[model samples]
Target chain A: MTVNAIQTRRTDPYSPPAEHLELQGDEPVAFLDWRDGRKAWAITKHADVRTMLSDVRFSSDRSYPDHPAHGGYVPGAHKGAIIAIDPPEHSAIRSRVMNEFTVKKISLMRPRIEEIVAEALDAMLDGKSEAELVKELSLPVPAMAIAELLGVPYEDHEFFEHNTAIFADSSHTDPSQRVEAIGKLRDYISKLVDARMDARGNDILSRQLDAGLDAEEAVGLGFLLLIAGHETTANMISLSIMTLLDKPDLLQQLRDDPSLIPGAVEELLRYFTIAEVGGLRLATTDLEIGGKRIHAGDAVYGLTNTANRDPEVFPDPHTIDFKRGARNHMAFGFGPHQCLGQNLARLELVVVLEQVIQRVPTLRLLDPISAIAFKEWGPNYGISELRVAW
Target chain B: MSAHIVAKRETCIGAGQCVFADPDAFDQDDDGWVVVLQADPASPDAIARAKEAVNVCPSRSISVLTRPEPGAGTGEAG
Candidate 1:
């Protein structure tokens, strides 16, 4: 394997490095990732990434000391979480909670999600011409939504939000700090799980309890959902807003045709495939992908961001095209472990974007795009604070 | 019109695009994999909806085969 053949770099947190984009083609490139200080294959082509994601031989268990991870944190304690497990067990655990995320199920929550977005918008735009959209609108919307969905009291969102931020932020180099944060979040969720066991409610935690999951397992599921439910969609919202404002014509197009919101959301997801470093998998057995032979125990990073921009699948992949049909993008990953909360995320994005565009007509960035502070060290790429004026 | 439905179970990620598109023809199993509800759907609307489901499947797991028209067929039906 040639280490110099590919070197992954993120000069801009929002966009994949030019070197990564240039390596996209029918072949998988081998790269030496700085984070793990390990040599791994970077799968950049769209089809190759999809195929690898579905192949059961490629495992998602990050407990393996050699597991390819952005930061030194392996999150090994999160093994019970759906994202950290393989099939059979993964299927069993995920199936119990799958019904909650179905299109029909999430659609039922649309009115509630809209209400949350509206409330956040009202609070943000109450008496001020300018506000940090990330703090005011993006974060709280999904945070409250997930809190309500999990039957956790929304008043405690600040606790989980702060802890989740530390856990998800890649820049927080202290592994012990992340572990402590996870421990606190897990303990908090365990308490909620215990409370639900005594008095069940209609929320997701109560439902998991009904499914006969043990307290620890239930708490694991709750932790996974709580962190994933809010952090990902929140980042997507902030990034989408940033991308939308940067391109005023696209914003105007969305403003004129609200029907185009769904399509626009899909396009934005493809344009900004924010799952930093894609989904990392360990090759359990020898495999061949994109004509390149992968050895057993090799760490293969599915470069979803680059795959979304593969010229072979998407024409002029770097350019944002709202008219383009990009629903096939790997922004959500693929295969059995494809994002379980995708339907809910899509619903949240549509509602939030529609409300912001329609209600906040005068919304514009307070600073230049480059001036915005982006969370470069997070597993997900998004702005830390988006100051906007109306 | 009659339609035959098939789901490539291995590729299905349980996105529920098929069930969402045509609940009559497709449903998810306990493990959330796609399960064909009606292999030989009788209604043209059902067949059309099944095709729509096949199109929307993120994993492209669902496939529909419609019986050939009576007079236009050369060999076998279904």
Candidate 2:
């Protein structure tokens, strides 16, 4: 391992941390020493990040105590949490629910998603000149969508969203509170899953139960979906809208040609590659990535944020080009572990952007970008809150 | 010779990047596996779409291969 240590903090809101960019430019793979006296390898270049993630030798199991993501790890807490497990268990579990999130299935939900977004906009703009966008629109859209998808009552969105925000936001310094929030969520989902065992519905949870998953497995899957489905997409929605508001030209471009909105969403996703921790993996075997030899049990991190900005892959990478239409970026990560809810998330983003731009033509930021608070310390990158008015 | 797209179902993880890239040329089955809708693109525009799908496919299951057509040229099909 080389003597290059790295930190995950991003100094600039729009870019990955300087340490990441420096390493990407200078080292394909470098030594990363976690603050807890643990060591790992950081793969930053686009090709190398893809090469590492695509290789199954890099395990995603987070149960290992030394795993970077194992800080607050609890064994079997979410029994079917696919992100923290390796195949064939991961493959078996993921395959069971894959069809639910397939392109066709998500497309079928488009009309419903449009309705959700429109309803959110209507509420945000109803007798209100100004509001907190995250509370009013960004959070509720995905929260309500996922709640409805999981057959959890959307009326409980405040409770669901509140606990999830506390649980998902790494900026929350209270570990005990985070655990408590998640536990409440888990119990709530457990009851939902238990009830479904008696009578099923046309939802993901009931379908999982019908597909032969036990109470615990069904509850786990539901819990994972609730957490995974909403918070990340909510963050993305807020961050994307914030960026568009900050750059009026880009906003006007999208207004002129709504066709460019999808591409703009892709570019924004790539540009703000949230989920900086998406690529943490433990090497299960000896491997060579970017010419660096990583032995078994070694921790490896694929800096997806840095990889998305690789000049070779994306010309003038820092500059957001709405016309890029590069779907090949690692914003959703790469390989079999790529985001399962991606299709649904993409559809949500497109729907929200289309409605916001069309419905609120006079929408403008109440505060400048400098005044906005960002979720810098979280597992996902996004704006904490943005004051906006139409 | 003509260029055409092919997909190996066994290798497909059904990430759906192909479907996102070119809906006209790709779709997924009930099992969430890639189903190639266009084996041979007829025009330059369609070929470009096929190439885009191939490029974005995470599993690298889709590819374009140039080969001889049985009746089109002085060459034999494989």
Candidate 3:
């Protein structure tokens, strides 16, 4: 494998790490040789990534600006929810909204998630073309699901989608540009939180008020949920359709047994693992992991993208199998920091894909597989455009 | 050997209960997303730690997993 300046100076819009651990034993893992000058160790193995994430020795402070995913951001302008910190600090902020992420909390919203998916799919199939599926089906499902969860009206989705795109797409732009994008999202969220407070209802925002977060923290966490909560799933919906269309057998299988869509979605998540890197974590102190020493204050990205592809855990690592034995992959991370929006994502994908196949039986890619566009990184791995014909 | 911990990411909901229950073993990322340190849940001590993290999580977005491997030992072990 080549490790040259071109790899390091990645400028293909956005890029997920392309490095892979050559599998030998039943368990093979490696660490990326990260850039120096405030750089931290990047743990890529399923084992190490899982360890580093839960290890209290690692911190998630934005002040460090350490993890590779945050590789190019400017400092001082960064402030966010506890998803960026280790507790007792992380706990102080997250405790305020813990109940909102539960199965029970989101169960009520499943009907709404279904409604949005139905609406998007109906429009998508009604007038077929080589449209950008990402903008059509992928973007809307999550945006609408999140909009409902936060009790934002469907009319407000354009604003929320814009704010989330700017916030989550930080990995793609220059440091200054990223700073501006984050500022815009924060400001937008702040206004939304205030409007909700004045018009308090039984939504998550109103509930968060009872927990004592002022306008800023409440908005920060709210913005976090809106973006991280659905963006990943949106990509999965678009990309997994591409994945299945490529494997018509799997798609047909899923079409036949709708129950399998949920498990199939899990399998797809394990196989594709859209997010290339776990969000960045800072080593709180010196540590030896996977036989490599990681010094304190260094940044590291738990490369979940790599971990999900580890051959030892997954046979023929690159293949997408519907019945793989070790299907549990790091697509959602692990430990205390595991993904909160996971079920919501899973629920959305299962329902969307199921209906997409049911509605459009001949949903084959119109363009050559090579013509399908994929975002290189940015917690999104999906086609910018997909032309489907039934 | 690397230290290990077990988590059901599908069940997790950024509750931060695991963050407080066992500060050494769990945390959230920038958007209140859970980042698991370990997921094997092999050792008894590790299993206990995971159980604590799972139990305290207000969202109950966690589960205890015990490794079937014969060599598995206790306390944050791989």
DockQ of each: 0.33, 0.57, 0.11
Q: Rate the local accuracy (lDDT) of all candidates.
A: 0.77, 0.83, 0.63
Q: TM-score of predicted model 2?
A: 0.92
Model 3 segments more than 4 A misplaced: A1-18, A23-33, A36-40, A65-80, A158-187, A325-327, A377-379, B1-78
Distance from true position, residue A386, model 2, in Å? 1.0
- Index of the highest-DockQ prediction: 2
Per-residue lDDT of model 1, residues A82-189, tens digit only:
787787888777767787776667778999999999998999999989998877888788877877788767678788667766665445338888779878877888
Question: After superposition, which runs of candidate 1 have C-alpha atoms over 4 Å from their true positions?
Answer: A1-9, A12-14, A26-37, A70-76, A154-183, B1-3, B8-13, B19-61, B65-78
- Over A1-390, each residue of candidate 2 has an lDDT whose tens digit, in order, gives 333344566667888988788888888698776666778898889999888888877988888876667754332457768888887788788888888888888899999999989988888888989999987788888877888788877688779777766765555339888878878988888888878888998898888887889998887787777667777898899989988888999999999999998899899999999887889898988988888899998888898999999999999999999998788899899876889888888999999999999989988899977788888775777877889987
Best by lDDT: 2
Question: Residues A133-252, candidate 3, lDDT per residue (tens digit)?
Answer: 766788788877877777777687777676555544444446676568667766766787889778887777887786677777677676777557656777788778887887788887
Residue A86, candidate 3: alpha-carbon lDDT: 63
Report the TM-score measured on chain A for model 3.
0.84
Fnat of each candidate: 0.23, 0.48, 0.12
> How would you order the candidates by DockQ, starting with the best?
2, 1, 3
Q: What is the C-alpha lDDT profile of model 2 across B1-78, one tens digit per residue?
A: 566788987667678888888888899999798898878887768778888887787767888775666667664222
Residue A161 shift from truth in candidate 3, angstroms: 4.8
Task: Give the CA lDDT, 0 to 100, for residue A106 in model 3.
Answer: 58
